[model samples]
Target: MKQLMDLANRDPLARRWAKNCAFDLMFGVGDDHYQVEVRGGQIEAMRERPSKLTSWDFAIAGPQSSWQAHWAPVPAPTFHDIIAMRTAGHITIEGELTGFFANILYVKRMLELPRIEGWLQ
Candidate 1:
């Protein structure tokens, strides 16, 4: 989670578009659960909770092992594509989809951050 925050903090694009947005991540694959919060493109908080009740303006869910694959650069699997996938049942989401497509470019730029290079691989 620190790594993700580091990436977001250093990302010019993330900083730009996250100006008024509050995003959260909730994931778990057994006894371990992790939650991360990002507001104004910076990490506001993080923690490991026994339950996954954390909320945010947006959220994505899936196995942690799928992170790299889901984030990998692909011609059709861009962040927008991910959102579509989630809506189509390829993945799962627990938030609003409105205006999500409008933020695709910003999302792409954030994914290009160097700190998150490993996740993209």
Candidate 2:
């Protein structure tokens, strides 16, 4: 996750997409879960367990495999696909959905960065 975040921070497209945006990432691992929130590219909050708060501007959640698969290819996965899967119970999210779909291309481009690919172990 640090590798991915580092790549995102250095990406021009990611920087543009993240400008003034708050993001939260939730991952499920067996009986335990973890969440991290980023505001203005810096970690604002992090926690375990679910909360009623929906303060983020965008949110993404999934198991490790699903999350990793999003960075597997040059184009990566689309927001539409991720949302669709979430809606179908394959993933889960809570927060504002606005602008997230619009920035899918930017997220994909960020995943395609050379530094990102190099850290894919």
Candidate 3:
């Protein structure tokens, strides 16, 4: 997913959406996890976390199957968006909500990069 985040850096909309926003987000795909640092609309880093205690502002976690479905070209209903996935129990979001909510749009757009890139297809 680091590649997906990297794609966001070149995306005009993603860059604009993230302008002036800085946050650290942890994305979990089953047992694997990644920490993505965004500063002033650029993704500074996205690396796998070796320990669970690694610091991050917020986290969005779900099983691999859930993520795969959500990344599908035409995602299944409820899997198309984060809130829908969370409400349907397909994913869980935790940690500091203030940062998450404040940059929710950016986060959402970041997550959709794979789909937008047609990488999954």
Candidate 1 off by > 4 Å: 23-32, 50-58, 73-80, 96-116
Q: List the candidates' TM-scores in order.
A: 0.62, 0.52, 0.94
Model 1: how far residue 67 lies from native, Å: 2.1
- Per-residue CA lDDT of candidate 2, range 1-121, in tens? 4545566677777777666755565545344555656577544556767675634455555665555454454423352255555666655655565545655555345434533565445
Candidate 1, lDDT over the whole model: 0.55
Better of 1 and 2 by TM-score: 1
Q: Compute the lDDT of residue 101 as modeled in candidate 3.
A: 94
CA shift at 35, candidate 1, in angstroms?
A: 2.2
lDDT of 1 by residue, 31-93 (tens): 455666656656677677725455545455655434445555552443335556556555455
Error of 3 at 12 (Å): 1.2
Worst 10 residues of 2 by lDDT: 71-80
Instruction: Give every collision pair in model 2.
Output: none
The residue-level lDDT of candidate 2 at 117 comes to 65
lDDT scores of the candidates, listed in order: 0.55, 0.54, 0.89
Best by lDDT, which number?
3
The alpha-carbon lDDT assigned to residue 52 of candidate 3 equals: 71
List clashing residue pairs in candidate 1.
Answer: none
Candidate 3 residue-wise lDDT at 102: 92
